[model samples]
Target: MPDLKDLNSIYLIVAFVVPGLIATFVRAQFINGRIDKMTDTVLGYLVITLIYYGFSIPVISWILTFEQGLLKTALWWGLTIVGPACFGLLLGVAAQHGWLRWMAKKLGLRVVHGTPSSWDWQFANCYAARFVMVTLTDGSSIAGIFGTASFASTDPTERDIYIQEVLDVDANGIWNYRSEPSGILILAKEIRAVEFMKEL
Candidate 1:
């Protein structure tokens, strides 16, 4: 006893709502801790949905002229499910490659990279260490320790300071220190600042 108007409205609602919700949920689950991933996923879904409807609508209208209820509904649902999934996958791949990092830099965000440069053996009776922080032209920052500077072969004029350890600051302002292995140089760009520590 459902009227044609109500049935049509339901179909329209389902066509829009189902795909949006699924895309949002999939993006939230797969892309964690990265803002670019989330944004790309949403944008991709929007583009794909538009493209799908653009081509499908004319064909669907013709089909509706011949076929009625259940068959048309099935076709609509099938397209809804497939379109968002494909879009989300594409966005996820793009996000993993640092596209967001480049964009963020263009927006004048601060980027920091930290590494070790030299060591003061006199300061630390047990160990001598140097640190370097490379704050890029961007806003995002990366901190890492330079376990060995001799192998780094970096130019002295680069304003690089050797640090013993790299400190990673979370969004909450908590600091976690990670040490690098000897003879290995850690390179990060778009950093804020770098600091060095000496223990006697």
Candidate 2:
């Protein structure tokens, strides 16, 4: 037979830790930034878990206290997992859409941002129908259709790109698509800058 003390400890851990891990994982998908140290990460999760439990505990108290059998088990898992998931997703969406940033700005925290870099912010807003103009370090430039096939690296360290349907610029600086090359890959090292356009 399992020790009651051991079982209580397990229950306490499950009640706190699992939901936190799930919440953090879900939140990370929307908010990107520095990787915290392990201790900091653990403390962050614990805080998130506690805050979540404070609100959730009251709502699920009856089900937890009285429900039995498979229904109880299902509800318990849902409370522990799905509840936190929804909480995290709400947080993520808020953070991603700048609701958090807007609040921070109102609070005069001017530097608060959802993405780690301007590059990320720009690429995250990239639309399939837009145009991309990439200027090279060697005084040349590449124009392309930023269509469905194009890609920009999300990795902060890897600024490379695969732009589809390469274009040529006329003397008047208008962008027109080239027929031969279907796509092109430009390494981060070669790029000096990039610009986006709604129309070529």
Model 1 bad stretches (over 4 Å):
1-6, 33-48, 51-73, 98-200
Candidate 2: residue pairs that collide: none
- Candidate 2's TM-score reads 0.78
lDDT of each: 0.47, 0.78
Per model, how many backbone clashes are there?
29, 0
lDDT of 2 by residue, 1-200 (tens): 22447988778767777688788778767655334554567667778888898888676887867657998898888889999999888888886677877888898887646577888777665644678889999989988887777877866787898987888999999867666768899999999999887853
Q: In terms of lDDT, which candidate is strongest?
A: 2
Write down the TM-score for model 1: 0.33
Q: RMSD of model 2, in Å?
A: 4.2
What's each prediction's TM-score?
Answer: 0.33, 0.78
Give the alpha carbon lDDT tens digit for every residue of 49-125 in model 1.
56556756776676667566887777656668865665555545444344555677899875541112332212112
